[model samples]
Target chain A: MSDPVISVAGIGKEYVLGVSMSGNMLREQIASGVRKIFQRVERPNRQQQRFWALKDVSFRVDQGEVVGVIGHNGAGKSTLLKVLSEITEPSTGEIRVRGRIASLLEVGTGFHPELSGRENIYLNGAILGMTRSEISRKFDEIVAFSGVERFLETPVKRFSSGMYVRLAFSVAAHLEPEILVIDEVLAVGDLEFQKRCLGKMGDVARSGRTVLFVSHNMTAIHDLCERSLLLNHGELVADGATGDVINGYLSGLNTDASIKRKVSNDADAWVTDVRLIYEGSESRQGFKMGQSLCVEISYETKKKVEHLGFGISIEDCIQSTRVFASVSSIHGIQLENVEGEGRARVCFPDLKLVPGRYMVTITLNAKSFQYDRLEGVRILDVLGQDELGTGWVLSRQRNGVVWLNHEWLLDGRQ
Target chain B: MSSAETTEMPERIIRPKTGLIGVNFRELWRFRELFFFLSWRDVLIRYKQTALGVLWVILQPLTSVVVFTVIFGKMANLDSHGTPYPLITLAALIPWQMFSNAVGASSLSLISSANLVTKIYFPRLIIPLSSTLGTLVDSLVGILLLFVFIFGYLFGREFGLIEVPVGVGLHWQLVLMPIFFAYALLAAIACGLWFSALNVQYRDVKYVIPFMLRIAMLVSPVGYLSSEIPENYRLLYSINPLVGVIDGFRWSVLGSEFQPYWPGFCLGATVVLFFLVTGVMFFRNTERKFADII
Candidate 1:
């Protein structure tokens, strides 16, 4: 390789939780020093909790390479990105970079609420390392991309949450650096704005700049990145082609077969457990586009509940949009004077959802009030497919939650 | 957007560093635009939505002068070396307010601007330095009101419409007033660098600052003259850096009627320079852990 654009060598970051409370104060620091003279302790910090967010990680990326970082919540993905972007210093090892770096971990890093949108655009741009002349040159383009031209003079405090996010994201999207580090910033804004943001990211990836992307959305990672790194806990566990790495991550998650969790213990009647039945078998990992999917729920009641109903909501985890929702009462099915233990199955014959991970929330409701509700109970993974007989496979960036049933005609007739 | 060869690009290595106590002048110079914007933002927000606005700058010292003129001049009958008590009190109060406002805000600046410090990487010194610079705008306005008050009162006396005592001499000494004001700013920044760096670690430093400034006000010659201090206690009083500032202002404005105490002023200057050199070194050494702790 012709000189990697970014190189890291055995980097490790350790954090001491609630550390040096005694050292923070002058009196406490002095007192601790006096005691240390008398007591011969091996370690002065025996009580402080030391957590290694990242340990002994080494990687290198060449010029124009786009690498994806995939891991679970505490897999050290963010810590690695932070060390690369210079937001925090690592406890051990070192990093070398040959190009200018700009990382976008959060949108609108230094936005002031009291300032007008026009003033904030400049301030936020400057905070992100843009010179004044550069901001002035792109000021018009930034405003137009945000679609908030009419309210540019108004304070951002009065903006709707959607408008605020769009304006903030617009300023960040225009930054052009030799190396870009992004961390899950696409999980925001409305569906239309999200589509535009994805389009902008495509333009960035095609421009041949080195990118290090960290995200939980597998589809986005698979579609954009050619190489991937998988982290488990604080160590680098896997690194190779994107498709193989994703398979390793998914299989790692499949080790746990139970797809049920107890949400709360407050209600008189509650759901005991839940599982997905696919293709006449109990499976949480076997799902695809255009297949019959069933959600089976088991419940117990303290007293007999009249006209009991079970509700289910399928929400898009990537886009955070609700795809489908229904209750047994709405479909004219109910159990009268339900008692003891029982099972209910809700099935969709032709599941038209696009290929992506989704969250399932189940609730138990009587005629008067809700007995118990379980939110984000289980994650349902649907594998990508080519149902349309073309080269287009499903991903979060290119598709919505559900595919429409419309057809296109060459003429006015179909 | 150019796809040039990567060989020419400047390379940087990031690692945990120790014993880097000296300031990097080139890095601070490179981020000068950020400094200007931060200081401008503070000045804009300080007077935002207030009715009096910049008027409050002039009004603050004027009201203090009235109270001291009556209490110290009319009741105690303290010596002013033939100059009017009100004129001398205004000169001293001007520097006192400037010192207090700059030091107080700049000391808490790093804690208040925690969002910027934790998110971005620049010279962390910019936050405290910008806040200290923002108060200079108010100082400029106060100096204008001082000149107008002196000239307007003398004009009325010239016309014989009002009876007032003349205490100011329009001489070459007046041109040196900016030097004293600049010296007062150095004192504030010197103390602010120490307190603000400490404030990031121990949050109780926030509560200790206001109480410390209150004690500072009593020790300096704000409402009283440094000349009136007893001979036995004079040495102890001269250790206060602001005693030199107030004395310099009174000398500059009141001319030969009041002379600056050179031995005490020289001692105070020496102490401030010592604090400044040590404070910069301490702040630079401790800044590496700021992001993790804050």
Candidate 2:
């Protein structure tokens, strides 16, 4: 087999917490100098602590392989990428690569506002590691792709934010490095422009180049990368196929206790547990398309309250777009008098979400006051062929976040 | 989508190194285009929307010359070494303005470009270097204005409208003017590197710079000629790097009694060299933390 294109061994990064001085350089310099002189007489302070941002991260990727990295915020995803791209030096370990690597940590990073769009194309392109000759060769293609040809000579400060992002992304896409490193900066522009960016990235992956992608969008990760790595609190928690890694991440989220709201007195109510039920059984949060799904929320009320309201909100996890929100009052259903520990279940006959994760939020209201609202209470994963598919298998062309129920008619023509 | 399209480039290994000097000149050479663009951007932004535009460049030193001529030439009666006091101050102000402006701009370059420093990766030295180069355009304009004034003086004499005790003419030493101008830029970069690196951590440098520049102007030969200094302290005063630069400017343009003093000039050159080397070393040492702390 061919040699791996990128290799990392025992990479670790440590950052000191709150020790670096921010204000008054001259005074800080004098204080540090004095501290150095009195080092033998004094002990280190409590604030001078070291926290590792990454710990013993080791991985290898062959040439032409695309890998996705998934993690929550402060999970060391950015730190790992920064270390690999040499933005910051690691506290320990080393990395070896076998190709010219170009990282797009941000779009429009070095663009000057006063410069014209045509000038910025060359300026930003060079900052992204493209030589002058290379930018000139691809100048026409980039301008056409951005579709801002009419305003090419205008200053970037005059362009709208959407136009600016489009031009920046276009220049970045034309960079022909052997290995490309990208962060979550693709979450810009309108949906159509984002689709084009995905298409361009797909083309780059197919053209025999290595790619390392990091994002919070799990659906994009699942569609683009076959292999995945999951990081948690500065450590590599899982490494396997994309499906299994995502499953591992979701299951890990379940271990943390349910978030409880603060109770001012015995009269307040709070949500205790949340679960997803499928097929009349205790399902572990995974459901199939077209199957009946229900969100069960358990809560307790210490004092009796009248006209208490219960509601559920479901949001598409990948897009972070709210898909459903309804309250008991909206349906004209009001409960009166005594309340105690009980469970509220909201049912959906057909789960229209196309194979991806959805986040369920539970809310409890008493009269006009909000008693408690638990966000991201449970992550619901939906699987199977889309409901609109013609057969048991779904094609990539028909992929979307939602599966709408509709029919098409055809007419015969001469 | 063809496998044969990949260009051949050298493979690089990245690892942590603990040392004072770890410059990657090859990597810097590859990013030369970025350096050019950064300076070009600075030049464009400086003159973008002002009503006077590039005229402000010439106006800055001319205004300073007028103030100095009134205060020092008429009020204080300082010596000008056989040259007209206006010409003396203008020549010295041209180079001095470039030096001071380059230093001021470069010292603040890292802070002003905080977005690029935090989000991107390139050699950190490029920031101060490009900012220093950005002030070169104004210096060129200032130099052209000096020539215009000199020609105006010549026409006034040819028409017999004015009389002066001293002879005014260009000399062979004028060819060496570029060498001295380059020294001014080098000294600016040298001092700028020190302050810019420190300014990232302690913002006091921002307030400290303009006050420091005011004091620096008084100590240098901007208001008077180097010949005015007592013979014993001439070498001591040249220890300030700008003294050699100002002295060289007057000697190159006006000639005569303002000949270049080799001993004092060498001492000033040595001081500039010392600042340049130490400033670069300090800057490189502190650069790795800028992205994290700034």
Candidate 3:
């Protein structure tokens, strides 16, 4: 294998919050001045403790490898990317990068609102270390790719959010840096633009350049990256193949099921907890995809609930797209009167979600009308044969999320 | 993956060091087109919507000369060292206004361009440096007004102002005008570096800078001649740094009636150089945090 294109060792970053207030105000200024004159330096008025944004993180990426970094929020994913981009310095550790790096950490990163798009393209290019002639050479191609030719002379401040993302992503993708780091910028663009960006990233990776991609979308990660790293709370938790790491993250999330409960200060009503039970056992823990599963929601009511119906919605976790939803009334199971404390269970004969994380939202409503409801409650991980592997899991590709068992007839001569 | 096998292979294409300072300078040079573009943009934008447009540049110093001539020349009966106070103040105003405007604008350059600093990697110094370059157009316009005043005084013969005898010996040392202007630019850059860095952390620095510049203008020898300063306090006055620059300008243009104050000027130049070097050091040290804080 070729030498690693990027090597990060023991990298950590510490930030001291509220340090800006130490000596600026009039009182602090005079106090500091008096202290300086007397040669009695006061202890640093450190009102805040040091917080580590990243700690002891180590990783290596081989040349031409496209690696995906996946983790939940506050997982040090952005911190690690910032360190690699050199936008922020690490308090301790070293990182050696082999070539020029261009990062699209967010859309419209270096764009000036007052400057026209044409001027900003050049300014953005210069900031990425491109010479004037280089930007001029690629100018038309970038404009065409961005689809902003008509508004080229307009200031970017007036551009729509979609237009801004398109132009920004276009500049970043066309820069041709040896190492390209992209954050979740594709999440903002339209579906077609996102597909184009993904295609461009794939093209960049195929041209023997290193790509470090960060996104919460499992589909994108699975489709693009051959290897992946998982970070949790500033620590390197998992590092391996993309599929395994994503599965590990999902399963790890399942064991710590904090998504079941709801607490609120409003006095009206709230949900207590949600659990899935199957075959006389708590089913929230694990369930293979296409298996029969039952979800139970426990709730508390301030007053009394009459003519109440329950609604269960299963949504694809990654994209927040709802796959299927069924209300108790819609399913012809009605509870005319519900009082103080109760539990409702909705059972699916065959759970047919593809291998992915799914969120179940429980809604309570009055009969023949709408009422107070909890939108999203418990989350479930559905494991497929490909996810569970052949050794320990049954092969059930016969039926999936969609049950389309129709046969098509065609003439052979055509 | 054996170490021996890897060692046997040729060394990877390691990028050259590109010394930190050299790389920074080269980056600035490569971005020279942007610098010119931004400065030109500033110039065009400044005058675009104005009714008088570039005439304001000439009007600024001309009006200031008229005001100073009334207050100091007529009302106070102050000594101008035999030259017209209008000429003296106008010559001094050119450099003084340039220095003030450059320092004032450049001080906020970084904060105003926070979006650029946070998103891109370029020498942070370029923002302030380009701002100073933008003020040069205003300075040139002020200088043109000064020449017009000089010609008016020569031919119009207003207010007992007469053209000097033609054969007066010219000082060869006056060729140091560019050197003095360089010192002024350095002083502005030094102050700009200090303020821009502070502004990134404390945003209150933005408010404090204009007040400081206003007070500094009243104290500097811009509207009044340096000769009017009491001998005992002249040295303290020269410590302001622009004293030397204004003195050098009047000496270079208005000729020998205005002698360069060497002792205080030299001390002021030294102070300017010290501030510049230290400013560069402070700016370099704080620059790494700009993206994060900004």
Candidate 4:
């Protein structure tokens, strides 16, 4: 496929945690020499530790391909981009690519606060490898796209956060590099600006340039990329079609039991385990978007309890907005007068959720006081089916966290 | 089956090297318009918030001349070799102020813009070079004030209160003023390259630089005339590069009997060139670590 425009082989990066001292002065050199001489008897303490931020990562992207790198925090996504961009050298292995690269690893990265917005646009463009004539030709288009034409002569330090991101993204997207590497910078601006940025990225991809996008939002990744890579704890866990890799990543998250439980030393109660079942049998770890699902919460209590309520909540991780919550009282299920050890099961006939990752939380409470809560007990993946039609899709777009059934109005003639 | 497909094909993609040593000077030259904009921004911002505005430029060297006249001319009763102390001191102070200001500003240029250095790729040398150029505006203003003072002195004497001496005609060699000023600028640029490179790795260098400049000012023959030194020790005294620059300025402006001090000028020129080359190499070597460390 056209010699793979970008090739990364066995790339790894190591960083030292503490300060490094060398022979910066004559006295320091003599002191270090004396310490080395005395090392025959007693070794001096070295307070440095090494961490591998990225390890043995290898990937290839064909010419004019848009690839998405998806992962949770600390998954080595940024380190991979930094190495590919050559901002820093990899500790081992090698990478080879052809043509010019522009990396938008950060918004407003090289902007001088005292410089005006118009001035910084040219400066940022040059830093991205654009010539003066190229930036000059595109200057008006950038300013107009950013919607900061009225404040063009004002110093960027005075611009609001939204204005800053708009200007920053405008300069970056218009620079016209052969390969573009962007990392979550689009998440900053308002909704309309974000949509514009996505549209611009789509245009750039369609124009035949290679793009490497890193983000936590699965829907954005699925919408933009045909091929995707999933990173898990500095390892390449999966790489393939966007849907398959995303589904595989969601399933892999369900099997991690330790990650579900919140461990606290001073807690009165804590969740120990969580499981999902259906029809009296352990079903596939997750459910379809509108399928019946059962959840079981197992916890330990340090003291006897008289009155307590068990509850479960579903929340969208990206937006951190709670979607649906139910308490034991609402379901007519309560465990009281005996609470030394307990397990509670809650079942929903049809849990309506679009195809995305949702965090399930378990909480135990006595009236207004909450004894304990497992912040994120389990991650659930709900798939979509055709029976719901485009109505369900509209609801999914309106509120990404949950899917609720509702009726639509008709005209008087109908 | 015979219908032609209307699908569009994807464009070609290319990737280039991102190493600091691989900085494309051609690209920097291509972006020269941005450099001029940044340099102009620095010039404007420098004076924008100041109270006295551009008047501070003329006052800086003039006030220093007054202080030097009081301390050396009146208190120490130093000889000006038949020339007025104010005229001689003001000529020397003009170039000295420009040199000091350029070195001080350029040395901290990298650290001052830590936010910009880590995020983007530009020729890091441009920061210091632009800051050095920013000081030229102040030096130009100082030069204008010096011309006014010379005109007044010549006019007042022509009105007959003071006798005008013949054969003390202004020498055409005064055109070398620009050359001497260029030499001083080169010296400042050389020191800037050294300090800015060092400041990136060790922040203590920033604090130590002002102290070093203070000591240099005392020893650089700015307040005292080079003629005060014994003829035998004059050769050793001129080893301080500013001594030759100050002697040249005073000789050009005030028509002093002093010679051009070509030996001192040659030594200063050699030292400046040496620092300039080595400073550039050192700056290039340390530039790779700036993004990581900064």
The two-chain DockQ for each candidate, comma-separated, is: 0.49, 0.47, 0.17, 0.16
Model 1, B1-294: lDDT tens digits are: 344746568788988776666998997997788887788778877886689988888888888889999988889888877667878888888888888889898989997888777677778898889998888888788778788878876887799976766566475778888899888988998999999999989877888989999999888988788988987777678899999998998788878767778889998999899998998988998887777776
Interface RMSD score of each model: 2.1, 2.5, 7.1, 7.3
| Strongest candidate by DockQ | 1
Clash pairs for candidate 4: A98-B14, A98-B15, A99-B14, A99-B15, A99-B16, A208-B11
Q: What DockQ does model 2 achieve?
A: 0.47
User: Tens digits of per-residue lDDT for model 3 on A1-414?
Assistant: 756768888888877766443444545656756867897656655554567878888889887789999876678888788778777777787887777777767767657776788987876776666667888999999999999999998888899988988888787778776778878777878899999988988888888778899997777888889999999878889999999998887666554454444444333345666777766565554577667798877766666655667788876656545789888887777666556777878887676666656767777666655554544445676775753454544322344344333566797987
- Model 4 chain A scores worst on lDDT over the 10 consecutive residues at A18-27
Ranked candidates, highest lDDT first = 2, 1, 4, 3
Model 4 lDDT per residue over A250-279, tens place: 666566645445545445666677777766
- Per-model chain B TM-scores are 0.94, 0.95, 0.86, 0.87
Off by over 4 Å in 1: A19-46, A256-414, B1-6, B161-167
The lDDT of model 3 is: 0.75
lDDT per residue (tens digit) for residues B156-192 in model 2? 8889987643536667888999999999888898999
**Which lDDT value does model 3 have at A221?**
88
